[model samples]
Target: MMDWRTKLLDPTPHARRDYASLATPVYRGSTVLFDDQKAVTDDWRQADNGYSYGLYGTPTALELAARIAGIEDARETFIVPGGQAAIALIYLSYCPAGSHALVPYSAYGPNKAMAEGLMRGLNVEVESYDPLIGAGISDLIRDNTTLIWCESPGSVTMEIQDVPAIVKAAHAREVSVALDNTYAAGVMFDAFAQGVDVSMQALTKFVGGHSDLLLGSVSARDDVAYAKLGPIYQQLGLAVSPDDCSLALRGLQTLAVRLDALEKATLQVARWLAEQSLVDTVLHPALNTCPGHEIWSRDFSGSTSVFSFIFSETVTAEQVVEFINALTIFKIGMSWGGVNSLAVVYPELERPGVDFGGRIVRLNIGLENPDDLVNDLRQSLGSI
Candidate 1:
């Protein structure tokens, strides 16, 4: 009895729908339907209250958040646009305009950048500290100190932090501790069990597995932390794509298998590199030569594929570029945790006192056979 246009806009389902599939449905929408006017409300606590709006997350994103929370044993997890967004969320949530925070010198570069750029502009004082400082972090805490950040087997240099010691020091001062847990994939290390207030990961890496997506997660260890983060998350509107969430779900299915294979192949390559005459230091946490390797052994259940090694002083920075160009299988690029191996030289990489002087190269071992990867490295090193 209505016009065809009216029929086309009908909200009723046209097909019988009792069927189900193992895959998480890719739910995409900007609007959510309410049963009645009384049921409509906007709340970001989708895990507890029913989902209110698409910006908070449809079912797809909620499922990914739930899975990450389960893996980390957290009270809740918030899905964001990328790993950087997760860092911003935690900073904005805990470090107010006038507060002070502590971060390891070896944290993800963007994290330090945020500390100097955005947080500084907002009047927050973020101080970089030694990754191995451990309980000494207590001395750095001031009356206004609110957050302490740890990144184990840190960015390029792979300096592992004494997380439990740092946590104890911060808790005594009634300060919060947050960790960049992306290196561990929320599985290799237990962030919540270590007494961290929040644990964040770049799901783009291990959780997405195939280098096909960009996503991140910020998880709260308890209800107190959850209550602190939720409102800020809503205000920021850090929504993620449902398609990416579906890929992450698929990645989770094979996560354990992929990790097992990656660990074996990576250790093989790292050990081979450690023995090479051209290599000065291999920064794999599983190896004893790395800084804070003892702490990593105590805190981590396993190590993953990405790590770095420094060229012996005998090799010049220019030769590092030549070495990267000579590689056959290990492609020259940045961003790790994928199906393909990667190598990139950090000519300007430095700490407070030590300088790599363009001689450090970071590697992300892929699913390639260990022999082939080792051969690739050998030939490349020979060229240098």
Candidate 2:
């Protein structure tokens, strides 16, 4: 038999038929049958076959997980309710009470919030560090440090972290590394190959390119972490709907193509934004002027469609609202990685000492015409 990776990428008959049916059939069930009592007992122990119970996973979810694992070059994959749950699972799996964790300062808002609010209450020391610390992270490791969390081209800030350097630093101290790879969506970066122990993604964004489903996946480099987390994941009763898994599987089929188009168009728009008098700087990893572009270029194969920019002039909340409301092509929404373009303004809710300036706008480029997006931005900026 051919390698599953080759089979997954190739336009083979099996691959097409997997979803060729007008709609990916949903396998809804809470119980699974076995041939006999002995077989059921064996399955209940998870000693044989690919599945045992609905929460453990079904054929539909398994197929999606296999495809994602193949893409990430990981040993196993676990599908969770959403991205935040995936992150939470990693924390819950490894970080015990009285443990310490290193999290990027500019990571997704929820991630920071979880580390600060929930983990802190649990007696876990979650320290926020600069994402650019890279190899220097060795200095931050403590006896209780158990996990180091990273996010490349961070959510709203779009700061690219030096993943390899940080991974090397963490591994030296026997610390596990987890990356919020939702931004790059595994298209740009390979977390496992970069020495990361586990990789997590919000399939809701890129993998579910249509943005019609909410799903998250955690891919473990080897069985160590998988074996440790699998039981916990099962115990938590975390499971994605078979329909959502099927949708994510279908989205994976065309992810590379959709991401290619979106990334190219996004870079074009970023360049145009950089040239505008209203813009102070374009926060994109692909740009040579970005703070961590060298690391991004060295560690990543490509960039995602999402990026942000800072305005030259500080604009009021009302002005920001007007700018967003004036857009014709870009829709005002929360999450990105959809086929439709999106625009959102990041409010100035910085940490006490962290000054990230005032006017930062994040843009999620879609499969839309670049010229039209540029024109829409021009009009919006003019209105502002």
Candidate 1, residues 91-196, lDDT tens digits: the string is: 9999998999999999999999999999999999999999999899999999999999999978999999989999999999999999999999999999889899
Best by lDDT: 1
Please report, in order, the local distance difference test score of every candidate based on alpha carbons. 0.94, 0.85
**lDDT for model 2:** 0.85
Worst 10 residues of 2 by lDDT: 41-50
Clashes of 2: 0
Going through the candidates in order, what is the number of backbone clashes in each?
1, 0
Candidate 1's C-alpha runs over 4 A off are none
lDDT (10s digit) by residue, model 2, range 1-384 = 899888777743453444466544677776777767776632322323545788767778877888888888988888888999998999998899999999888888899889888899999999989888889999999999999999988777777898898999898899999998998896578898889899999999999999799999989898797787787787788877999998898898889899889989999999999998878788899897677988888888888788888776666667777888899999988899999999988777574375545577889999999999999999998997
Estimate the TM-score of every prediction.
Answer: 0.99, 0.91
Per-candidate alpha-carbon RMSD to the true structure? 0.8, 7.7
